[model samples]
Target chain A: MKARSFRVLTSLLATLTALGAAAQEEGVLDSAVVRNRLYRPAGHPELSLSVGLPVQTHLTAHYFFDVGLAYNLFDTLAVEARAGYAASRHTGLARSISESFLDRQDKKITDELEDLWQMNFHGVAGVRWAPVYGKLSLVSDIPAHFQAYLWAGGGVGSFKRKSVIQCSHVVDRTAGVCDDRTSLDDRGTAREDFWVHETRVAPVVSGALGFRFFILDKHGVKLEVRDWIFRDSYRVNLLRDDWEAGRETGEKAPSPGLTHLVQFDLGYTFSF
Target chain B: MRTFPRLALLFTALPALALAQVSSGEQPVPAPGPESAIPPEPVSASPQPEPPRAPRERPPPVTPAIQHAPVRAIEASAPAPDAPVAMPTPAPPPASADDTPDLSSEGPRTTDASQQRLVNGAPLYDPNVNVHIVQKKRFADEGHHEVVLYPAVVQLNGKYTNHVGTALHYVYHLQENFGVQLAGQYNWYSDESHFNLELIDKVREQAQAASSLLLQWGVQAGVEVTPLYGKFAFLNNSLAQFSVVLSGGAGLGATRHLIRPAVANEVDGQTFQVPARYGDTGTKFLGSVGGGFRLQFGESYSIRLEVRDLLYTARVDKVDGCSLSDFEAMETARAGNQPFSDLKLSGGCKVEKFDGVDPKTKKNYREDIILGRDLVAEPSSDVLNNVSFYAGFSILF
Candidate 1:
């Protein structure tokens, strides 16, 4: 009777052992399935839309809109192409002086001061490097992925601005007669005013630092600080105060020099 | 002696312990207490085959409990063979599984092929293919013809007035180095108030009054040589084309010297007007040399700035003394074949200079015959040197 009891006990133990083994195997398979779902791969294309506030030093400031297309050459490297419209307004000092000149009774000087400040349209192609990538989990359940990147490029900008000149009454409004007072040269029939408009094309070098936060897998928001270095040769009365002093002494005014611009932007990005 | 027996009992019970473990499972279990030890028996010591049970029979009530107890013990003791290894968790999948792309299968995402490659952290080449590259036009291309028209203000150096004029030029380029051009210009100068009325009246009385300051027109045929051609970036970005052309030519010119009455006189209480007269009108030979630069704005349009120097000689009729009524004396002196005399003054007396005796009259003549003491005269002929500049638009075909 005892022998029979022992056999039954052994058999029951064997059955329980098999059940335990089966449960462990099932757990392993579940873990693997979860891992496969979370894997992320490299190499994707990104598209972005950006709106910027561009400030040109001592020149103008305005809003700009840009659309960019970029491709990931590596896990952390990309090439980007951007085109944008830059709309700008004259600086406060520039505007005030322009308004003052425009209010003058002399139509010639007023016309020259009109539209003296303007914006430019530009294009850029650059390479971006994402050297730092990380994640943040401020909330217990939600996590965020982000990257810090820097970029540099070169491009062309089309700039149009008006040129201004100050003249004396004896020199005539057109100033063409200033040199030869004795000669009766026919300065073209007076248009109600006098001013010369000039357009220029400039080469620009640009650089930027940006932070991108991926709110979703393929979408993100970015904040950027960028600068464009270019030369602008639009003549303005930068030395208007000194020039007015010189004018009182019958001296000629000095000419304007070259300047540059900077911009800050917030944007959205989509990756493919 | 007590220890030896206890060890002996322990050894003897080992077989039963092995049998019980094998029946329960592969999991190890704690050994039973010595106080509960049982003697080794044949059924426990020898490996024995047990009878198979019916497949439908139910397991004993202790079976589930015993099976679970060993399993729980083994789990607490050591990990199972198939248990997951402790490792960091991977990132979660995208919001939507359908949105996750297989990057390897996708086509080239970048617009430029070179962007796929990298050097030093930057793209190997610029991805923007639309960058503007300035292309210079070949000079020897066919159909190089151009026409230009300009309205210019011309000032003749040493002349009192500026000439407002229009100029036209037609050029046919045979080669980059040289071309032929035909040019013409017409100018008109208005009268200016530089001299007083009294001085003008004195000049008019001597028949040398100046009316219009300048009136001239001319046409020229020339060959132009382009000695230099170059390009520079405007605002350091845009390409601008420039060429220097040197030109030389000869042409015919017409000039007129007009005289208008300086003052009106009242004769017999009736105001009489002095009719205007043409003092001289002549056509002369002229030569010009010039140079200019052409700045190209587009494929078909350009701006040209030129400076030219013109040389010509003009003839004027000499007037003697201060009278306009010397016609008879001038004719008699000419018919008599006498040397032309310059009236001079000595001690308030009018004197005329005669060189030798008159052959027809057979009379000796004084060499220094005084006509008047304070006579003033103007010269007859002069050379005019003019430099002009023009700016205009040019069209190329």
Candidate 2:
């Protein structure tokens, strides 16, 4: 009778073991949406070169040329350092206002315009967090793998301000000319202007939303919309007579606000 | 002591295990291969399987008939039940499943082929066949309606004028890649930007009339086409689908121009702040072209980020139905303390708009006659492009 009980117990144990194996297989059937990533950047170092074009121009426009070095800590995160020089200039609207303001003697007492600061040389270190990875079917046979990422960082930059309202030495008042040109009609002939200029070093913050498209194995193409933000500092409550006569006229504004330089950047990268 | 407790627990669960087996059907489950996990393909019985093609060749378009057909052996890892795996499916060089021939009675597929396979499912005789990557679509968007609400549409290139508003759009999917859309936008806050105001305040200069024209509202009918779609994994945990959408439309928009900025009014020895004034510039023809990404979440919800350029023809010949001649007469009449009621003006002119004095600020509207005249003196015209960023969500039904 004891032998019969042992055989029944053994059969029950074997049945449970089989059921457990089937359950484990069922769990494996629930596969990940994307089973494997095509490109992984972890533990790799990369070098990049980029050019930035102004998205919109108000008083000023900036064209940035930068080179970056980055190290990927993980598949989704990286640290990077970028250094660049921006070739900056005043927009046509700013030039129009500056030339016309030279002749406007009726407006004698007014505050200087805000957001005249322009960035030149800058360097920043930032972390890039790429939380999204995907692939695009470019054509019948080609699949493009890419990552969407956000980057943010802060650094110091050399900035300069050229006053549109204040010309230190006016050449002609009635003709609305502030520079030394051979003829009044052609302002482009002039090499320089007499606009009051100031230069300083200040902190700048930059943020971007971008995509990195992986090519083959080590190469990538990047496109992004980046914004460089900095605090604005300008003089307020100025006298036209004081500035034209080459005399410092106004006091610094208490709260001048912030300036945003938005640009669209296209870049290329190579990984090591 | 631990052994005794474990034995008691196993005995206690024995009845529940037996009940579960009884509830579930008695059919012995197949040893789970990836093919066993797939539900039965709704294809015809005894269908002949196509020979495998090269991996790089374009797959046949997926029509309704082909979509219902059994998943091909090349597309899935499993060989047909009848075709033995040891013998390579003969005919063409080994290729991805995308190279499959169109066997459906209907015509070729218009949309893109299925996504490339990422997971290795079944073992193959040729190791290279294992690299063949293509899988059928898991979701379809044909014949559905989507209503999108853009809570914020902020102007990106606000050089002279600033605009912020909301927009609502309805889209009907005619096909997987094509759709028809009706879009409407209303700008509740439209005004001269601070940059323009600063130029006026300090340099005594401002943007031309046409350059600073503001859009109050617009309505457009357009078509949207999605050229590309893909899947993305977020933080290695969540997955979402996205499509690159491009759209174009032509329509009409209402516009206005700033007549006067806010100023302090002194009436009877007391200073009162008077608000800025805007004059209606009537409706103008508008056109739009835009492109962006639509990130879809599940079946009925999505998030869209787009940049649209709202182009409008701006010709400022009249303001508030008052032409240059009308403004000249109003200014002449105001110079001499004369009532505008007696002046002869166009029948459509709203002379009353410039005749009254504000009761709160005690500011006279007649003082704005010269400013109104200045706007029409040159009759500036421009094709203004107001590029803006739109962030919104959608509900698909």
Candidate 3:
């Protein structure tokens, strides 16, 4: 492990050195390596258009659709907005194990699952900046197909996630689903309907390097993958407390699962 | 093989047998755990050699007499509160029974009518330590510091755990408890299950039972004797607790998938075990703040309620499982190893430790094969944005 780590470190250092050399050849100074890059002054394409799919690591979504545009008036900065749609689902389980009402006393429980699904839509807008370009003079010819841009911008994005969960019982002897709602927190209690949702400003701070695949008819397309740190919250059901109460014999129906959301997000950029 | 059938028969006939045991005049005593419930493997003083440690001969029949005479129980450890139950119920009583045990079977203990009627005689808590199992829900995550606890009011706590699977936890409290909690909490969420699994995607029913247990303990430096309170009106003698848990814990999570290893073909006849990549485990961060209320019950047992918020990092892992979603994308197999078989971790476990890869073949493991999409991968509701209060009885010696 130690040797492998050493090799990886050395290789990374060499990569950094190569990048520095590439920049030096362009006459870009050392201090401005990250900031100085070329960009064309903006003539906001009369109408900016974009369409892309959402990408997430775990949460399932039916599909995600994104549409956005940018109007760059100056070579240094641009304004942009994007709207997205995603599908999400909520799933839960009610666990109960059956034993011989005979000599065996302990029963190992397995969670019985019920799932819920829903969709959400969100949007964002921000001012993008290219600090190095539009300010410095370049003696060498700017590359026609490439521009390394450093953009720092903040925008608001939100999503609405929802779901519905149904409970079923498992008979130990049969080990099959039974009409036994008793496995649920409310078991035989009257069933109820509820809703949970949340909205928060998702951060769009990012840095990118892209090559213009093609620009024509006052239109241009670029492919770039960027990571944007973000935050959001959602709700979940109240089954765990109910299970605990079940173990305790007479414990009351716990407050239905409290609903809260985890906060974080990452974004990729595809320009058109 | 015959024994297994007989065992199955025996299991089916258990309830009837119990009824017979209760009604029979000679009262055959059956030890709950194992035969060792009796005592004196070698008796010291007896002229006629006695059958030592016989279940029927032993005393304290209703409860295991290991410690405080257990209150009567019916199930494994439930309090059978009814008259007949006080004698028949046998749960939660043996939590503290491991003291100087007199495991002698030929003793005075028997299920007498008087013992069953004696309700108020048992101690507040059960004593058979081995018999009692407790699983406490911990909101170990203290939430996001950027939103909640900041510099002035530092929130520090830790947890550690050890279990058959991935139930290990440990934390260090650096200063929250007066510089006591140097804590690190990890909620590892990876890809295993997905909620949006399509119907044609139904998998053979099985248990992908992965569990997590947390432990939090560390140097508690604040006024050791200070009392905290629960916010509820009914709470009494609330304890202001702030401690860091020395963290050392591991998790072994097992998920079983009903596999259908099929081969898919390309434009040409060359086939491969459907090459697919599984997604992430949607684990999240859980944070909580609450205290126990030692309700003025017979014992110092309390009602514990907590207000907590659970946060999940935006998952970068894809949520993929065997589903018709990609059914159209499958190809025919060329035949070497099973396509899904590639997911098997190789190098015997220690060496097969690659994240999301089939360590054995070093191939892209498909989630659909290992963890079907219908499998709930996101933190299950059991550990979701959870918030609940437990009003159970607890005792501190």
Candidate 4:
């Protein structure tokens, strides 16, 4: 074993020595870098569409579909405006909690849960800063060029919240049913629900890190991880009896904190 | 077998060579080296019989600047008069007519040498011998060893639980694009997330014990493959090489559970804040699959960003080495204020762990016996997936 180690060490030293010699023999290293960038998007106008899926679902899930318009002022910078609607739904865990919480009458008073707001329509204007540009050899002959960028923006969005704990008109309390359904076991037939609902317009902020890979002329593909952040507002210290009798009950929480919805976005762009 | 150490040496030394070139920025242009400047030995006067020459390809037509250039001293690295040279495939035209240089034009050299961009001490004005956007790989990883340290591995998809930790990994490259790895990680902070606490607080509902089980530390042996590599420039100033790596492994990991959350305790009319308590829940089989990018700096160092999913089977039937039956006995002993030493219990049960009082907080360990029993009442089981983000740096040698 010692002899093998010695031989290995000797071979490594010899290999490194040969590499140094070869580097010098080549005169100079290949230093001619990105000066000859084959594609630059400066002064170009573009249209793009993107779809975002939730990275992780907890109480809710959101799928966002958006369309965007952008103008590149330089190869490294651009201004873009995006507008979209998000399709949202409650998760299985949330539904399970709602179904069970209705039967637990022992807890006479409790606070409403947080992070129940769902976004519907939204628009934002953002700046994209692409500081990294380079080329990738896909195979022996094909090459792919790409840019890494960061985007940040803020705008107003329409949001709505439906309380799972509050059911003003209970259709069937023993079976834990609050909706207008024809059968007790089948919830699919529900036409309307008695849960308390509220709607508002609030300011939202978004940020992302993404890569844009240019294809043939005038086209590109993008992949990104984006986070939509908004402040959470909910009620606390509610009287269960008051809410069950179709009456307003709780006061707003002093500090409701913030909610973040993280998504993975895939997009396509067409330059005009 | 002989190829193993050669690959190790290749992976180790290649990064160092790349670093040496990057750090040699002081000289924008190296002085003409002695080897390339030496002319070939006189062909007319040879000491031996003439040998059959290998066939070679014709060189491309040179532009005026290259034909009458003053930098003939640096031509040593160029191919001999009758040698084959590989020319990179030229890039396609840009989407719009912007500042992109037209490589197709064979017109007079417009840019002066001084105005030319200097990369790795070579001017970009010379395309045939120097400028290459997607050049051949300058480093090889075969037969090399690398050690990586991740100061922060944060759980990205935490719904019931969250984990933050530091990890260390070692890899031996058996081939240029494939390697074997041994990895170990220790999570300093692992707990049921606030979302889980909110469910318990606002809705009186909580995740089962197994669903919120925490991983303390893990070790695994696996294989890694780098299928693709490329280079890019940062805002036209700096250049770096990167590879896409995917890896998978299976091993063992220590698990635990939060027995109790922090609460205010009253001791002799003085209230003290007691910290949360955790109970050891034994080890479980661990498996992971991950993918990420490794951006090489010079030759020896690199930055890695990856996402990994760690999966483990969690069955909360025991805690602190005490099984359900042993906990039942301990709970009865605690209720009756009887000595636990007389009870018939499993050999692995560590009874002393649940029979003492905390020295500072004046909290009795016996009070937790009931909570531990509640966890294993029905024996909840789950396969927990801990997906996390790993950001770290590595050194190859």
How accurately is candidate 4 docked according to DockQ? 0.18
Rank all candidate structures by their DockQ, best first, as comma-separated numbers.
4, 2, 1, 3
Candidate with the greatest TM-score versus the true structure: 4
RMSD of each: 41.0, 17.8, 35.4, 13.6
lDDT of 1 at A53: 73
**Candidate fnat values, all:** 0.00, 0.19, 0.00, 0.21
Off by over 4 Å in 3: A1-22, A25-39, A43-46, A54-56, A62-64, A84-119, A130-144, A163-210, A226-229, A234-272, B1-397
| iRMSD, per candidate, in listed order | 46.1, 23.7, 41.4, 18.4
Tens-place lDDT digits, model 2, residues B1-397 = 1133224334433432443343232222122112111222122221122233323343444333222222323343212333221221112221211212322211131231221112233222221232223222233456889999876676656678777778999999888778999999998778887667777777878889999999999999999987776656555434444678899998999999999988999988999999989999999999999998776544576666677999999999999999999999999999998999999998877898888898999999998888888999999999999987666767889
Superposed on the true chain A, the predicted chain A of model 4 yields a TM-score of 0.87
Q: Assess every candidate by TM-score.
A: 0.30, 0.77, 0.26, 0.79
What tens-digit string does per-residue lDDT give for candidate 4 at B4-35? 33243344344335534545443212111111
Candidate 1 lDDT by residue in tens digits, B188-250: 432322222212221121222232224478888988886654332111112233466799888
lDDT of 3 by residue, A1-272 (tens): 11111122222222222222222211111111112111233454323333333222222323445565666655446776655664444323212211111112232222222222233465566655532221111111111222324333445445443321112222333332223444544534424322222244444333333223223223445443322324323222334234333322222223322111111122333332
Separate DockQ for every predicted complex: 0.01, 0.12, 0.01, 0.18
Estimate, for each residue in A78-171, the C-alpha lDDT of model 1 and write its tens digit.
Answer: 8999888887655654433332342333322211222243557889999987644433322222334455567788898887664333322224
Ranking by lDDT: 4, 2, 1, 3
- Candidates 2 and 3 compared: the better one by lDDT is 2
